[model samples]
Target: MTEMNYRTALVTGASSGLGRGLALWFGKKGVKVYAAARRRPQLEALAREARASGANIEPVELDVSEAETTLERIRELDDACGGLDLVVANAGVGGMTDGRNFPWEHAKKVIDVNVTGAVATLSAVLPRMVERNRGHLVGVSSLASCRGLPQNAAYSASKAFLNTFLESLRVDLHGTQVRVTCIKPGFVKTEMTANIQHMMPFLLEAEPAVEFMARAIVRGEDEYGFPWPMDRAVGLAKFVPNVLFDAVASKVVL
Candidate 1:
């Protein structure tokens, strides 16, 4: 295993949630961080907080949904840093639609950010990483990818896409120094999950979740899902026969 002591990193969707947490985590370790988000104020606020930790943070106002502009900004930021050691495609949205209603727009938006956006982020940085054979790509996918939920179909499917994509990317980059990691976290307390409007089993605060994620990245784990109890529960659910699963999972209060 190659040792990873990243000096610089780029984290997308850093305005809030896991993205912000991870950016700050890296900052604390003395890694220069380029944080990107759609909202300028939030990015500025994050940079301020990071600076307070004595971490260098460059705030880049970016919307991951805009693939072209997102790529352009990534290029500019990478150039400014001279290169990138890690890129976490963490920007995402949730569409809480149920089986009763098929909201095409919501599903499409989920796919745009969670799926297309992740690939675009990879596209923007992959060339340079390949050339150098040294970089880490992490997709902040959800443990929700393990099982599809009734009201969270779109969000579930989108994350599932990310999980699969990252896994395949890892295979493609097997012999290279460019490593790909998929982090499948369970319910986490963040602005993104604030609107979940239901119970999240084993919900964890961002700080601890960031700790787990940071460890995973440093260890170069191909797949990381936490907290462990939730990961096991979700992974076990995969083996439940559809009939029993439908009866049990469908009755889930959330």
Candidate 2:
């Protein structure tokens, strides 16, 4: 296994879910971790947890939905750290919407957080990485991005956009020392997935999921999706006839 021993790292959405797990994982490896999230209390709690384990983690209050401030804050953090060896744009939101009712507000929020927020976080750090000629950027997408589902179209679309955005970054940065990785996870047992009503095939807890993701990041994989079962299912779904897919997907409650 490749040893991911970055000196300094920043993880957005580090207050909870996979983000929290990733921050803790990095911290345990002796990486100075800046844990950014909208919730200050949660961030503090996470910091305490890390410190208890002899991990160097600091809490950073950040709300990625605020584009201008998010960009400024991330850039400031990057500079303050001398330089960030790794940045994970892991902040995102999920929503369930019905096409018939068309909840524009909910859909808009999902896009704002998942797509725009991620772009802001990445764009802020990218320039410095390019200038330094070394850094790793990772974006957390979803397996749902492989296909649009009935009630969760907005969330799926946002992840799809992120996947494409990350792909573009990887391709454009070719031959550069900077690396870009996109991690697409299936249903993980996080707050986001807690309310999912339908059966979640190959469900994994947050810690294991984050571990899998960390390995991929350290290996500098351009794009990765997990677990293997979900990845295969989604891959096959991509080739299914639209009519048949629609017929089956429409029945999904999530």
Candidate 3:
């Protein structure tokens, strides 16, 4: 679809990281952005930048885990915009965990943000998109979903859930005009990975990464994974024998 096709878009997690990058790109492209995030100041900053770009932007207060209220607020924003043509369920958390440090709350919070939050965000907008029969839905999965990493039990699992969810939705919505796309990025330099202690090969900066994703989104791809090398490596991991993979993965310090 053309850039002009999307008059209104709602981007969750727009306060920082990939979400912010996507929001900025969307605004730059002249889409009215419903920027959803938990931080008022950051969202305000986004609104200011959008204004400078002569873009229409509304910084909607959102904590994606707050499923009920988040949907309500998003619905209100959609109503104000008259309609929403694109919805990016990008809010997620990568709560670190270790064998000894694993806690129910920590893992739960990660799942709540990465999985349930996407569900809630999609749940809120999908019906409207289906009803209108013209729109795009984006879920940001990760290359981590291709395999289970030792250090990222919750984080990897959550992303795998995202990949699965979006693909399932794509099949379910096959004949509809509504489009569903799942983007899996290997490593994009963002606040989330700023302090990551392991090697992140082929990590793209946020802007370029979002730009690539935007192109895919515009084309309405079913699923796209990028930074080719990492995508290939991760995709290949799915076919590796479990025992051999576990033996090698055990050596991964991070």
TM-score versus the correct structure, for each prediction: 0.95, 0.97, 0.97
* CA lDDT of each prediction against the hidden true structure: 0.87, 0.91, 0.88
- Candidate 3: clashing residue pairs, number: 0
Report the Cα lDDT for candidate 2. 0.91
The best candidate by lDDT is 2
- Off-target runs (Cα >4 Å) in candidate 2 are 1-5
Instruction: Indicate the TM-score of model 3.
Output: 0.97
Residues forming the 10-long window of minimal summed lDDT in candidate 3: 95-104
**Model 3 spans > 4 angstroms off:** none
Task: TM-score winner between 1 and 3, please give it.
Answer: 3
RMSD to native for every prediction? 1.6, 1.2, 1.1
The weakest ten consecutive residues by lDDT in model 1 span 1-10
